[model samples]
Target: MTASVVLKFPVFTVTEFRPLDRQIPKNHPSNSVKTYLPLKTPRFPRQVKARTTLMEAAQSGSSVNTSTNASMKLLFVEMGVGYDQHGQDITAAAMRACRDAISSNSIPAFRRGSIPGVTFGQMKLQIKLGVPHSLQQSLDIRRVKSVFPYGEIVKFEVVDGGMICSSGVLVEEMGDKNDDCYIVNAAVYVGY
Candidate 1:
């Protein structure tokens, strides 16, 4: 019978276990790396537009409502963010994107921040389907907008995927990369 041993590190001696059946192949290319991973991300800000009724209504002529929107900032902490091979977590990177959104929105920093009990900040959201080649989805037309517990957001859209633009959302930064969506930190202007 094999006996279980209780040992503490620094006190007990340890040895590396080498696999007897396998060894690194001699002919393997130096740069060749193998790993089980998902698809490579396309790009930040995805260089796409998520058009909705709002965007269309804004651009429409005559009877359509012509509204102007101001920018704002909001803080965010994403749980999932990472690279497929390197195990890179994109949470901080996504948060950085959210922080960048603040200045991009043209709203005062403090205005987008919370004042404790007073409640003066934008709420977080989960990105459903990212904007694609057109404003509408391939199958259905969805009116995409950042939802806030407070109220409706005037004007907001995807900026970049964290590659080229600043104010945008990244699903990799939302939840585990394995998930389809992630948490989104948005900037909303209230009292306007």
Candidate 2:
């Protein structure tokens, strides 16, 4: 008879515990939910409001303080026309146009400090120049700006409308000969 042997093995099993609930700290960076403070919009003063008040005053027949007002006034309007015939010198014509614009009227607005937040140096000039289309390229912008002697913020705008007169006068005394006259018209606005 042969010898016989017997062997036996043991089995094991694992069980997991229920997940524990805990409070998340407010300072925790990993928290998904967040709260933010409300912000305020800024406010600014409007010129329209002041003008409305001024209008009210006018309606009520009350004297308004025009001196300290920040409103810009139309001081004067001057119209001038210049001609350069000999060389088709648009700059010279523009200079003469500007001179003609200011020649008739004097602006004392710069001398008055009654207006609030305005000064002589802060005088604003809006210059509108009308020149022939052919002479627009020949006109020097800096030469046009140099015509204003006082310190001013000049806004120059050139448009395509003006008279180009026919000239018969010779280039006499170093002036336009009247062969090809370049006409320039100007409108100057001076204000704070």
Candidate 3:
């Protein structure tokens, strides 16, 4: 005698049977039944390619040349937020944001040679900053690039983002200029 079992799921259905003492032949056609189910394909957001080159000079003290070609593969991304409560300097906020993003991360893979054929000097970085639209012209791109210690800066872009709100206090001595505070967001993409 044989015992048969059938299981059904929203995505698929399976049917099979087992004998009391003997096992069914592996190549038997009727031994099992499999039904294919229609599945919806998953959708993913599009990736942003690096377009603009922010820095061409080697500021990180490394002599290795960095390539900004489209062939590079992105490994990961780090995000952070920063704000300037005084002086109303948007560049300061942007630098803080970049520092905040990379401060907590440790990339041993590059130094340890975990990525085959990739060296620490060969690392590539792309930075995207979000600043208030009104203060875009005031952003100092060169000063902000100083925050990065290593890696080749391939792409740097500034888009309208972040926020502006009252800090509730304005002091002439503190260089407040005004009570308004400037906030900036940074996204750093790391790759080889």
Candidate 4:
């Protein structure tokens, strides 16, 4: 018995009908031949054009306008995740997340005059937090703001995210109201 297989593509189609139990004889002309097909046009015309444009722009050092303030150019972004296993404090988790994000980083570009016309005093930061929906009200924005030692907070947004799961054990002395553990994610965008 033999089976037929058909493959369809935007540029071409292929149909193969071969024996299931036996291979084609080695002496057959089809067994020793190969075919190469040339494409008349690109399969993804827009993608090819866009990629070339992006490469040219990048090579020319052209910056893209992303921030609302045209003067503010994004330097880098730091991300971190924190969780409160013992206590059900969302703010504590958020603070820890922020700390974790910036702890390992030391950015001296502003003070060192790495960026032309920019100074440490002009540094701006945008903080985005992910917290559970139910615990959004309990999050202390002021306390979270205090985590940053410097930088002017230009934008702050809180979206419904993060997770609440069991910590496996609840200790009354540790202020665990329940066995629920609160997790928070933080993204700090640094720009000037």
Candidate 5:
């Protein structure tokens, strides 16, 4: 027999459980050492919700459909930087991830329904870092964040006879140069 597994992190996941009450020896190894006891665990569910990328905000932002039967590919790009208080390149992982995603086999999602003049749609995705990593512990980078005062959603238009199309972009940024930290800007294009 075979089994399927889904894994999520940080809370109430496969390995998360509250400890049950049990007596422990007074002389434990650590000061907080109460005892090595089993936790109150719930029975494994025979079934669970199976929707991908809907459980949390981060999942929604970075979600990808994995069904191999469909020829279309949907992709998202992410880029950011970690800055110390001094503002030097703490990390550049975000830029690398975004670059790989855009250059890989994934493409952006298109309009599901049709419009009068539109036959297909194109999307350009980008992620920019505004804050230093020193403050990152407080923010959830995995989730979508609207740095703008209001929300923004890019629109796609699939116009007629779109045999060949071209796109162009320039990404640049300027911040406290004296701080000398890393700020990541990334771009993505999606098509099927």
Candidate 6:
């Protein structure tokens, strides 16, 4: 038979047991072990309002003035990176990356309060792409530009970069099929 004893501390309580064959005093150091655990709180993000500014038309020649012949200086930047597996399509991977970058952001930069007389279609988008050397020529610029629906002046610039990994697999069981993996990087700039 065994007997159990309970010990109380300022932070925690402990329960210990001993065999009936041994008689050890409760005050002994080996008889009890005390432990204390701390609880942690979680953190969250806070939203902040976007800043606004008013400037003369001569200072910024790109925007058209609406009220008082003055222009509103509006600027916003958001960036993201993405990856695609199995599809050796460079353009498709780049499009996915671009989509990932802008998908989470909701920017109404053309509103009258920010940029007066500036419409959504007037905004210029510069899309820079980094692709593998082997797939540089295969990347379709037209398809890349199609990713942006509202920008008036959307341009795509492809540079020699990114990586290619060997998948050790063939497509359709063909000997000449492309079995290597392809990666593409994208950076989209939105402004007037």
Ten residues in sequence with the least summed lDDT for candidate 4: 46-55
lDDT of 4 at 51: 40
Candidate that beats the other on TM-score, 1 or 2, i.e. the better one = 2
Best by TM-score: 4
lDDT for each residue of candidate 4 in 14-87, tens digit (9 for 90 to 100)? 67666677777789765442334654564764554434343364457776655334565677789999899987
lDDT (Cα, tens digit) per residue for candidate 2, span 105-175: 76665667765666788776777889888878888988888888785644568899777777665675666
TM for every model, in the order presented, reads 0.20, 0.55, 0.64, 0.71, 0.23, 0.53
lDDT of each: 0.34, 0.67, 0.84, 0.84, 0.34, 0.65
| Model 1 alpha-carbon miss at residue 36, Å | 38
Residue-level lDDT tens digits of model 6 in 1-192:
888777776767777776778777989875665433443465558777763343343355556443221222335444555444555777777778778778988766565446776776577766777788778888777877777767654455777877787767666543325676666777776666
Candidate 6 deviant stretches above 4 angstroms? 1-74, 111-113, 167-178
Residue 162 in candidate 3 has what lDDT?
A: 96
On residues 1-192, what C-alpha lDDT tens digit does candidate 5 reach at each position? 323343454453342233335544656543242323335697886878676662353335554544211232334333322222232322333333334434444321234433233234433333343334353343344332333122122421111210111112222343223534333333332323
Candidate 5 or 6, higher lDDT? 6
Off by over 4 Å in 4: 1-71
After superposing candidate 3 on the true structure, give the runs of residues whose Cα lies further than 4 Å from its correct spot.
1-69
Relative to the true structure, candidate 6 reaches a TM of 0.53
